[model samples]
Target: MTSTAGYDVERIRSQFPILQRELKGKPLVYFDNAATSQKPQVVIDALVEYYSMYNANIHRGIHTLAEEATAAYEATREAVRAFIGAPSTEEIIFTRGTTEGINLVAYSWGRANILEGDEIIISSLEHHSNIVPWQMLAAEKGAVLKVIPINAHGEILLEEYYKLLNPRTKLVSVVHASNSLGVINPVKVIIDAAHAVGAVVMIDGAQSTVHLDINVQELDCDFFAFSGHKLYAPTGVGALYGKRELLEAMPPFHGGGEMIKEVRFDGTTYNDLPYKFEAGTPNIADTVAMKAALEFINGIGKENIRRHENDLLQYGTEQLRQIPGIQIKGDVAEKVSVISFVAEGIHPQDLGVLLDQQGIAVRTGSHCTMPLMQCLNITGTTRASFAAYNTKEEIDRLVAGLHKAIKILR
Candidate 1:
């Protein structure tokens, strides 16, 4: 696909090998970006180079290969620090993904601080990862789990959220962007409000990191979590950013070799700040390759990508709105390149199958936000999320595919 626009959409698309392939004898149209992004050539090359040349353990190795591997792995941590505008690398800890990051904070910090009769507040716009861990933590700690309600527009009602916050509010966790509806919550206001009540907040950036600019310092969130795969890197690797004081105060998430200072029968001394939480060897190769993914995004500049994707989002939403019996979900101005809708007479899974037959990829389901689905009065939605490399042509194809699919379904 090509574009006659200010941005080089073709050049960006060329860097992704998967964009050139054919699915069902048709050019692939990838619009499932919120689920996970397609990696560029640089990222794939980094992975091969790491595994082929320097496949060694990190942080504890002295050999040449091990030193090289460890440097590459740690480089990604620095890159993540820069990507999120974090204060220091000491505050960043690598994890299996955003899910692990949330669980880490919940188990470590939640257990340490939360007391009986405390309240943990989450929003209606959270992914299952952000919701389940806190629910479990609140239950275990004899703390109450409360949800911030949303309006009919699929947005977190700030007024209602304020009403929920009290002196007893311990932790407030929320998604930076709604995965199912694509609404960007008013997190800054939410964070500041939570702080007013002496509550620490966690922002789940799984769906926002790639599409939006993130600054943990500017956001003033106590903890921030994001998945690497959502940002064009490989799966099974993500980062959690915590304030230094909070991380130091909280206990370690796991007990293992790397996370230990000295292990003895008497007592085990944990390692320093970040490493204390990172237990095992981790997904070393993927973590190393994650730097390449960040570099790729940095080269193009996030502002340019955002503008291009915003254009695509506008075009896609306009084209879809014209189609009959298609009701777009979360019809709001403040959002990224995500469009979720449900057809009047068609099931989301069936619509997805038909679109897949046309080589058009879209996510169809509750999108791991069952509570949000229930709140929105929808069983599921057909979500088409865009990335940096996507174009108006692909969205046109999506519209055409939807028209054909809807006709048959009706």
Candidate 2:
């Protein structure tokens, strides 16, 4: 396993209370980080503090609790803005998760801009969240959906992607990284090419935001969406980063109490910038706690986290490759800490079950990217995703468990 000097992994692991638990007479080895990361005690304590101290609705109340709640909630918006290097807090609109963020854009921006003959482009590596919303938008608007092809290595075919761009290309929405394959795409190039065709680009940052350093301005993407849970934050909370001009131009995604300026029986005017997209009362407690998650990452440093995860990816890849019947998918040069594989004559679901019996948590399915599975000519894969707290010792346990699984099943 790779090592970075001065990185204390054990110290980091201690922060997560759930990691101390055991299952089925074995220590829990969590490898399902891609599904959802384990929350640290600090994040949990933040949630508790919010509920116990100042539990109130935000933006509408004038009391002390309301002011505190609103401040904490809005503070997260600024944190997210800095996290992704967005220009302003006004550009950050909070949503349920990555799925809702994409849907908001499709419903609001897609409906307002896309014409009958326009073409919307996406890659074969997108999650269903990124793909389905655009598909609905395209069908509703009579716009054509174009897909960029991928190589056998699971990297996007950049040459083929350029050929799909033309004047009729209205939008290009692609994932910054593949959730199933862990392949990091060249989004800046994709964005630049789409801009050349006068098309707006939206990046599904559900996978990338936690791993990579993202700057929306540098990437020049029109929209960027990511889930908070992927970055060690609470579920049901995410943020969408849209260009100021684009967010201002797009209509409100939902109509409700807070997203209003002057509501009359004749007509109602919408609120400015981010508030226009965030309708009604939001998940205030979770939103406030999300700031603590970001702080947790910042305290550890993203570089150190990346180094540790990459070490796990490398060590796991080597160990898994030694198994005779195992076939690893998506062997790309650049990837996150995810490994998807399948064994000969064994079903992934069955393997997942056996692994769980050994207290090894993994995900086994199409991973919400059925098209990618179909493209790769597989049913599904057993995925082991790593996080910062994961260690080489855990990978050793996983390898041993896989050997046991092979011996029993094969």
Index of the highest-lDDT prediction: 1
CA deviation > 4 Å runs, candidate 1: 1-4
Estimate the TM-score of every prediction.
0.99, 0.99
The C-alpha lDDT values of all candidates are: 0.93, 0.93
What would the TM-score be for candidate 2 when compared with the true structure? 0.99
In model 2, the clashing pairs are: none
What are the per-residue Cα lDDT tens digits for candidate 1 across 318-361? 99999989999998999989999999978999999999999999
Candidate 2 ranges beyond 4 A from true positions: 1-3
User: Poorest 10 consecutive residues of model 2 by lDDT?
Assistant: 1-10
Shift of residue 256 alpha carbon in model 1, Å = 0.7
